[model samples]
Target chain A: MNIIEVRNLCYAYEDDEPALDNVSLDIAAGKTTAVLGGNGAGKSTLFLNLNGVLTPKSGTMFFEGCQVTYGKKEMLELRRKIGIVFQDPDDQLFSASVTKDISFGLMKLGLTREDIQERVDRVVRQTGIGDLVSKPTHALSFGQKKRVAIAGVLVMQPSVIILDEPTAGLDPQGVSEILHLLQEIKDSMGITVIISTHEIDLVPLYCDDVIVLDKGRVVFSGTPAQLFAEPALLRAHNLRLPRINHLMNILHNKDHLAVDTSASTISTARASIKNLVSAKENI
Target chain B: MSGIDKYAYQSKLARVNAGTKLLFTLASMAVCLSFSSVLVSTLTIAVMSAATLILGGCRLRCYIRLLMIPFAFLVTGTITIIVGRISQPTQALVSIPLLGARYGVSADSLKTGVIIFLRAFGAVTCLYFFSLNTPMNSLLSLLRRKTPGLFVELMELCYRFIFVVWEEAGKIHTAQASRLGYDGFMRSLHSMGDLVTNVFLRVFRRVDRVTAALESRGFEGNFELLAEQEESSRLLEGLAIAATMFLIIIGLLERLLT
Candidate 1:
């Protein structure tokens, strides 16, 4: 099922050229979808449009099969169902305290105080930020602030959560930690997760589907395996195959081995290599 | 961390109710300012400083250093009060001839200066004691309850972004220094101009992004924040009230005696 559908989306900032031009894609429900693009590829703009933060110049968006409207009530309802975590945590976090920041969204929902507390507590535990709830947002580290930012959205219990470059500027451990939390969020809540990133390697490991954007257009939309298989197409868009897929390509082309070039993850590549070795032994 | 922020987080009274601290600070400041007797002023300074250092667990050296900030201002102000034109040479305890005028320190002028100086220092100490023990977040939360929502909202944003702007400025300064942007006076001036312009641009962009993020989370025209869990102790409140009464009593007794 499609949680969010963008059809012929076109957006321009002020008098500038279109940031998103005739872009269309369907984000699958209850799955992790990765939006891949380089700088100025309109990933952020698309996320904003989906949440009604920006109205497209000429396009239509459907949330759960209903065409989105620009009415104030309709926009608020859409925002309640769709939350966007900005690329910079500093931009997203307005409250000084972590608990208060997380509670901001719930307050908008007009939930009872007890319900708000319960939701905030659940997200704090889910994000593993129980200790930081009382701490000021300014005191948090970059990684911790990112968690708080995610928690702020997660507390709203949006069915579809969109993140703009969620793992940008994180250390290796921080990236893994955020990805792990996202995975947990997906499995436990079954919420549709959409993230935009240039980290080609993380897409295969974490995302189920891939949407490739280039020059403000949807160049490719498919599963990670299907997307990685077209290495030449990806290269033309200023993107490269994941490290494992690149290695598999080298093995097939230079080493003359029948390796699976479609394998994008380490474990998949390992299995493919084992199969190649066993086939050679049998021959 | 900034100096006040560091102590505020570590202060033993940090967990105390912000209302109690605010009330105590204001009441003490009122007494300190209202009293003209030197004894009441001296007592106010001593009591507030001790409460901050001993009860609030602020370091003595830090408290004394903060006191010196107001002390310097008080000295400059009190100089005029201490020095007077001697109408009677007999009244001059010490006299100096400057620019064909005789400037002298009289016994009466000395007493007035000392009293005013102590009163000003005492009022400042009360404020320092309150700020040192209560974190800005706590104070803001307290204000949110008592003050207008818009005022509190503006204060919250300003407080959070001040740190952001300071950090951005620091990063720009370091980047400039590494590239020898500050090697010469002229270069340093040029670098400063660039830094200011870049910081403003960055902060402007950040504000726009922050607005989008806020909207995504369902922000309407006004900001609604969660109330912090306040720790209120009746025993503490009683002790604070008693202390304020004691200070007031001292001030009254001094007034009666002097």
Candidate 2:
């Protein structure tokens, strides 16, 4: 089931240059989706529209099969259900303490103190930031800050969570840890996850669905396998194939190794290369 | 500022109730201002220094360094009060004549300057005690209950984003320096000017993004701050009360002695 469906969504600034020009896509429920785009490709505008931060000039957004509205109460209710973890944790995290930052959303929800605490505690445990909850936000490392930012949104128990450039500034270990955590979140909680990233290599490993945006339009939307298959089309949109997929293409074409050029992941590439070697070798 | 903030989170007294700490600070400040005696001011400074350095677990070396910052400003202002034009040379403890005008340090003015300087320093220490013990989150959350929502929210956001701006300014400084931006005095000034403007622009843009982020997180007009109730200790309250009473007694005794 599509958790969020946008049809011909359009947004323009005062300059009349479309930020999101006739964009349309569907985010499936309980699955991980990645939105890929270059700078000024309207990825941020789309996310803002989905959260009702920006009112779309045209088209419709449907959440759980109902059309999304921009009315005051509706927008507030919509935002509670479609939380966004911004790219910069510093911008989103206004409270100095990690637990308070997580509780920021829950505080406005009119819940009892005990209820808010329970939700904050659950999210702190889920994000594995139990130790960080007591620490000040400024004292946290960048990766820790990112986790707290995500926990802030997760405390709201949103049906769909959108993360912008989730892995923009993390080390290799931090990056993998965060992605694995996100995957865990999707699997365990059944919350729909949508993230926009410039990191093409990670999309295949972490994301089930791929969305490519270019010039404020949805260039492609499909499974990672299907999207990466069109390397030329993706490059035209200023994105590239995953490193493993690019390697597979080269070994099959330039090196003439007779391996499957379509293999996009390391395991699949390894299998194809092993097949090619085993069949032809006579050492 | 950042160093003090770090010590605040690490303070042993951080676990104490913020409201109690706040009350203690405010009461101490009132005494320091109202007593108007050298003994009272000295007592205020001594008590706050001990509270911050010993009970708060702030290192004495860092505390001394932080004090020097306010000391520098107080010295200059106090010097003006001590050394000024006197109507009568008879009133002068020391006098310097320049340009047919007399400037001197008088006994009465010197006494006044010393008292004012001590009072200011005592109040500064009292505040240092509060800030060095209570983290920004706790302090702001406490203020949320007593202050108007708008002012508290503004202060909360400002406290949160100040570091963000400071960090950005730092990066800009390094980037400019790498290109010989500070090679000379004029160049350094130009680079600093650019840094400020850049930081200002970044702050302007960040305001929009921050509001959007907050709105997406279901933020309405108010932030129902979630803070665990810090059990107010009877002993701590007793200690605070005892300190205030001690200051008042000493202030009265000093007045009697004079």
Candidate 3:
């Protein structure tokens, strides 16, 4: 069953232009979905709508088969269910200390002190930020701050987690650490994960399903392999296919070679290259 | 360096509670203020300088430098004495003219001026040590704990708003820098006014956003002690309190006897 369903959502800013127009999609339960698009492609707008931070002008959001309407009462419930990790850690972690920021969401839910403590401890431990508990938010490194922001959301134990550009503005080590923690959360906890990002290479590695958005519309929604197969469609949307897919497209269309063009990652591309060489020898 | 950043190669005073240090600082100032004699004020400076140096983990040199701030009054007072009363009492055998007037030198006013300088220096040193030892947030937290509920809430809101103002200032500075606002004096003056106006609007918008964020996070506008009880630190704090009291008592008794 679809854990989240959006039907014909439309949103505009100040009557100037549409930010999201007639966009509809479904997110599967306990699966990872990567919403991929170029800049100003309404991916973040869709995320804001999912979290109810922005209300749609003409569409409905359904969480677990129940339609969500924007009201103070419903927003509270929606906030509890949908955890949003903002692109910038500074926006999310405005608290003075790490401990306070981590427990902010849980505190809002009005959980018992013991429950709050337990959740905070668990998330902090999982995020590997136990040593940063006493440190001020400003004193921490960029990676540490990002982890604290994620811990803040994780402590809430939201049913569906939406992270907008989680890996942006991180060093190599910081990016790897975040990706590892994200994999651990999805695999171990089985929470529905929806990440809106422009990292196409990471999308193929981490996401089970890929949603391509363009100009405030859902242009394509399918598996990464299926989407990568259509290079023309990707370019038409002003988005490039993954590097490996780009190479495979060159081999298939230019070289007139019969080879599988579905590989979306570097390692798989190398293997496909080896297979193509062997297939040529057989021919 | 982190171990003794405030004082040169001394133990840390960062662990001490802000409220306790403030109260002891108040007591030091009160003792110093109640006296008029040079000997008593000198003793007051000695005791505070030592306490701040040892217990507050501040350097003696640093406190002395901070004490120099009150010298503006000292400079004015000294000139007043030299012109208004004394003329070369120690250096000159004859009167000197100031503003086309001759003034007589007095020995008693010289002693009074010395006494005034000492008293001012001692009070300023006490305040300096208090600020150096206690962290800013802890000091604010101490204020929040001691003040009335409504006032504490107002102060806390003010502290939170300071960050909002800082962000606004940062953006304004950036915009001005990009526009070459610092090239000329007139532009700089105009930029300052523009910065202030920008800060006001940013702060206005920030208040609504911050309040919403706080409400969403269930901040009921109260300070609860989230820290666990530190038994050893509490004992040390108590000892520090007693030691300050001891210094004030000994100074008072010595002055009375002398």
Candidate 4:
């Protein structure tokens, strides 16, 4: 069943300069979806709409078959189901200490002290931020702060997790750590994950499906393999294929090798290359 | 500055719990307020200065220099003592200058003004020690734990709003400075209107974003107290209670003897 349903959504800042225009998409249950877009592409607007942070100018959004209303009662319920990790960790981590920030949501949900502690413990252990609990948010390194923000949302145990640019402004190590953590969450738990990012490289590794947003609209929606198959479409959206697919394109054009460009992983790309080269030698 | 030096003051004071430091300051204020004699106030100042140096790792001279920052208050408060023609006998007893006035010094009034100033200093030192030693987060948590609900929320909101206002002020300053708009004093005054408008607009947008962020994460109204097991901080809260008790006894003894 589709976990999230959006239909003919439109949003604008101050009733003009539309951010999301006639955008519609459905997020499947228990699957990781990566929303890809550039700056000002309304990816954030769409995500915000999903959590009902911003009421759409016109359209319907549903979670678990119930249409989402902008009312306080509905929003509170939507918020519990859809957790958002904002791009800037500094803004989301308004609490003075790591523990308070993590407990902020759970405490609001009226969870008992024991339940709150268990959630905090589980998230801190998962995010590997045990030692940073007592420290002030300002004292942390940028990556540590980002993880703390993620841990804050994770501790709430929301059903649908939406991360806005989770890996932006991170060193390679930090990016890998975040990706590894995301992968672990998806694999270990059955929670639905929707991450919006400009980093195309990470989508193939972590996402089960890709939704490409362009000029405040859904330009493409499919598996990474299906999306990468059309290099021209990828180029139109200013998106790149993963390294493996990029290699396939280079080999297909320059080396005159005919091979499937759907190889998403490095290992598959290598095997496809070996097969293509052997086939050419035999001919 | 390097990270270590940046937090040099706070890092050294980090050994004490924020709650302890707050309680100690409150105790200091109570004691200072209980005394009217200049000698007692001075002794409290001396003890406070020493405590900062010995316990808080802050230098006395540097902090005293900091206290001198609002030198205008000292000048103004003393001037008020001279003008208020009260406490005549005490004035004759203490033959100090009547702050450039021909009026005879009122020892009681001068003593009273000086006590007020010393009380101010004691309160200021307490605040300084707390800020210097305890991290903002720890202090905030301590406050959330010890303070009333309305007060805790006010403090948290204030702490959050500080960043919002800082960014607003900084942006206005930058925009003005970039255009060489505020170089002259008169021109800077003119820009104040723009500064106020900009801050309001920015604050509105930021508050909306912050509220949205809070709601999206399921933030209910109340802030939860971190569990005892989760507090990882080893600072002793018991010491604060014990010290507060000792100070109360000292205050009672001093009151009875005097």
Candidate 5:
């Protein structure tokens, strides 16, 4: 089931070119979706529209099958379900203490003190930020700050969380940890996760669905396997194939190995190679 | 600035109620400033510094180092009051002719300068005692209950954004320096102008991004901060009151004696 659906969405700044032009896509329920785009590709604009932070210039958006009204009550309702963690953790963390920052959103919901405490504790534990929660936000490392930012959103119990470049400035270890945390949220909590990132390599490992944007328009939307098969399209949009997938492509196309290039991830490529080698031995 | 914030969060009294600490600080500062007695100011400074270093868990070396920075300025200020154009040479401890004027340190002026210096130092120690013990978020929360909401809101934003802008400025300075932006006088001035302008511009962009992030999390025009969970201890309150009374008694006694 689609949790969010947009039709012919168009958004633009004042007297400027469209930031999002005739964009339309469906974000699947309870699945990880990667929104791939280069700089100025309207990925953030689309996220703002999804969370109802900005009113789209034209076109309609539907969340859970109801049209988004952009009214005060409806907007609040939409925002409660769709949380966006901005690319910069500093932008999101306004409170000094990590616990206070995480609870800011929960407090807005007017939840009971016990309920807010329970949610805050659960999220801090889930994000593995329990020890850091007592520290000041300004004292956190960049990676730690990112985790706190994610915890802040997760505490809100959103049905869908949108992350703009979740792994943009993280080290490899930080990136791996964040992706696994997001994956756990998707599997355990059944929350739909959407991330727009330039980290093409992480898409196959963590994302179930892929949507590509170019010049403020949706260029492609499909499963990760289907998206990677069109290498030319990926190149045109200023994206590169994951290194493992590129190696598999070379083996299939250049080396003429009897293996499917469509198997693009590490696990799948390993399985494909194992099958081909075993088949050869039998022959 | 961020260093002080770090130490504040790590202070042993961080989890205590901010109100008690604030009350003690205000009372101490008032006593320190009102009492012209050098002995009372000395007592105030000793009590506040011991509270900060021993009870507040701030490192002694850092405490002394931070104190020295403002203490140096205080010395410069005291010097102006200590030495002046002398009307009577009889009272002069030392006298010098500078630019056709007789400058001297009088017995009366020395006494006044010493008292004022100690008084200001006592006030500084009291401020350090409070801030090092109370983290800004909890303090802001306390302010919300006592002061105007708008004023507290402004303070909260300013506190958060100051660090953000400081970090951005640091990064911009590094970028400029990598290209030798500060190598020469003329070029350094030009680079500094550019750096300031760029940081000013980035602040606006940063604000828009932060506003969007806040809105996505369902923030309305008003802030909805979580109520701080730190409990005020009756014992701690009693201790603070006792200490303030002690300082007042000492000040009053000194006043009576004189």
Candidate 6:
């Protein structure tokens, strides 16, 4: 079932220029979806729309089969179901203390003190920030602050969590750690995880589905395999195929090697190469 | 400011109830300011310093350094009060003719300046003790419970964004420095101007993003503050109240004696 579905959604910061134009997409429940776009490509606008942070000019957002209303009570209910972790951790984490920041959303939900504490504790453990609960937010490294930002949203127990460029400023290892954590969240809690990023390389590694946005329009919405299969289309949108997929395409198109061009990761490329070698050997 | 913040989080008294610390600090400040006796002000300073150093676990060196910041101002302020205009030579303890006017230090003026200086310094010490022991989050939590909603919300936002703006300014300064932007005096001035402009723009952008993020978390008009840990202890609360009353009584007694 689709947890969130946006139809004909259009938004504009200025009157003449639209940030999102006639965009439609579905985020499946209990799945990881990656929104792919370059800067100013309306990825953030789409995420904001999904979370009801931006009201679209001419579209309807359906949450669990009901059209989202902009009324105070309805918006609050929508926001409780869809939590957003912004691109900047500094912007998202407003509290001085880690535990306090993580409990902000839960407190807004009007949970009991004990309930909020339990949720904060659980999120701290889950996010591997056990040592940082009492630490001031300003003392944390960028990666640690990012984890706190994620934990802040997670503690609210949203059914659909939207992250804007979750690994934008993270180191290589930090990137993988965040992706692995997101995977764990999807598996354990059955959450609908949606992240918008320009990191094509990370999509195939962690995401089950992909939505490609270009110039405020949805150019492609399908599995990563389907998206990567059309490299020309991705290039038209100012994106490239994942690195491994590009190398595989080179082997297939230039070297005349019988390898899967859809291989988007090193492990997949390795398996495809092994298959090619065995096939040649059998011949 | 950052140093005090760091020490505050690491203070041994950080987990104590903020209300108790606030009550003690404010009451001590009030007593120090009200009493005209030097002994009362001296005792107030000593008690606050001891609390900060012993109970709060603030290093002696750090406390002295923090004290020095206000001492410079106090000395200049007191100097103005001590230097008086004397109409007669007999009234002047030490007189100097400056621009055809007699500027002198009288005994009465000297005594008044000393008392004022000590009182101001003692009040500062009381504030330092409270700030060094209680984290800003705890203070904000307390304020959220007591103050008007709008006032508390403004304070919360300001306190949270100050660090953000500081970090952003630091990043911009470093970026400029790496490019030889501060290699010369003129270049340094130019870079500083550019840095301020860029930081302002970035801060404005961040404010928009932060507002959207808050809305995403269901923040309506009010900022939802987190529930702080209940740190109230009957013994500690009673001791704090008693100490404040004791200080007030001392101030009263010292006034009577004088």
Winning candidate number (TM-score): 1
lDDT of each: 0.89, 0.89, 0.72, 0.75, 0.89, 0.87
Give the lDDT of residue A137 in candidate 3: 60
**What DockQ, on C-alphas, does every prediction get?**
0.72, 0.61, 0.20, 0.35, 0.64, 0.55
Q: Lowest-scoring 10 consecutive residues by lDDT in candidate 5 chain B?
A: B1-10
lDDT of 6 at A145: 91
The model with the greatest lDDT is: 5
lDDT of 3 by residue, A1-283 (tens): 7999999999987786898989999999888999988899998778877877778899988999999988777887777778877776655666554675676656556567777778878898999998887555655777898898888878778888888889999998998899988888889988789998877888788898989988899999988888887778988988778877777878888997776688778788888888879888998
> How much of the true contact map at the interface does candidate 6 reproduce, as a fraction?
0.70
Scored against the true structure, residue B143 in model 1 reaches a CA lDDT of 91
**Tens-place lDDT digits, model 6, residues B1-258:** 379998999898887889889888888898888876798889888888988999788999999998999999999999999998977767789999998889999888889999999999999999998999998888888888878988877777788789889888998899999999999999999999999899889988888888898888888776666667857767656766776777788878766776
What's the TM-score of chain B for every model shown?
0.94, 0.85, 0.74, 0.68, 0.89, 0.89
Cα RMSD (Å) per model? 1.9, 3.3, 4.6, 5.3, 2.6, 3.2
Per-residue alpha-carbon lDDT of candidate 2 for residues B1-258, written as tens digits (9 for 90 to 100): 468888998998887889899899999999999998888999899999998888888998999999999999999999999999988889999999988888999999999999999999999999999989998878877877788888987887778777888889999999999999999999999999999999999999998988899899877777767875566777778989999999988888888888
Which ranges in model 3 have alpha carbons more than 4 Å from their true place?
A112-115, A256-259, A276-283, B1-11, B36-108, B144-181, B187-232
lDDT tens digits by residue: candidate 2, A43-69: 998999999999999999999999987
- What's the ranking of the predictions by DockQ, best on top? 1, 5, 2, 6, 4, 3
lDDT by residue (B1-258, candidate 4, tens digit) is 223223432555664556567777777667767765455556566666666667667666666666676456766876686445444444464354466543555666666677677666666665565665665555665656667877877676666556547755887889898998788898888787788888888778877777778878766676555633323233335544554565556666777988
Q: Which whole-number lDDT from 0 to 100 does residue A104 have in model 1?
A: 88
Q: What is candidate 3's CA lDDT for residue A82?
A: 81
| Candidate 1 CAPRI assessment class | medium
Native contacts matched by each model: 0.77, 0.82, 0.03, 0.53, 0.74, 0.70
- Proportion of the native interface contacts kept in model 5: 0.74
What docking grade applies to model 2? medium
Q: Judging by DockQ against the true structure, name the best candidate.
A: 1
**Per-residue lDDT over B161-209 for candidate 3, one digit per residue giving the tens place of the 0 to 100 score:** 4554676598779979898997799999999898888888876766655
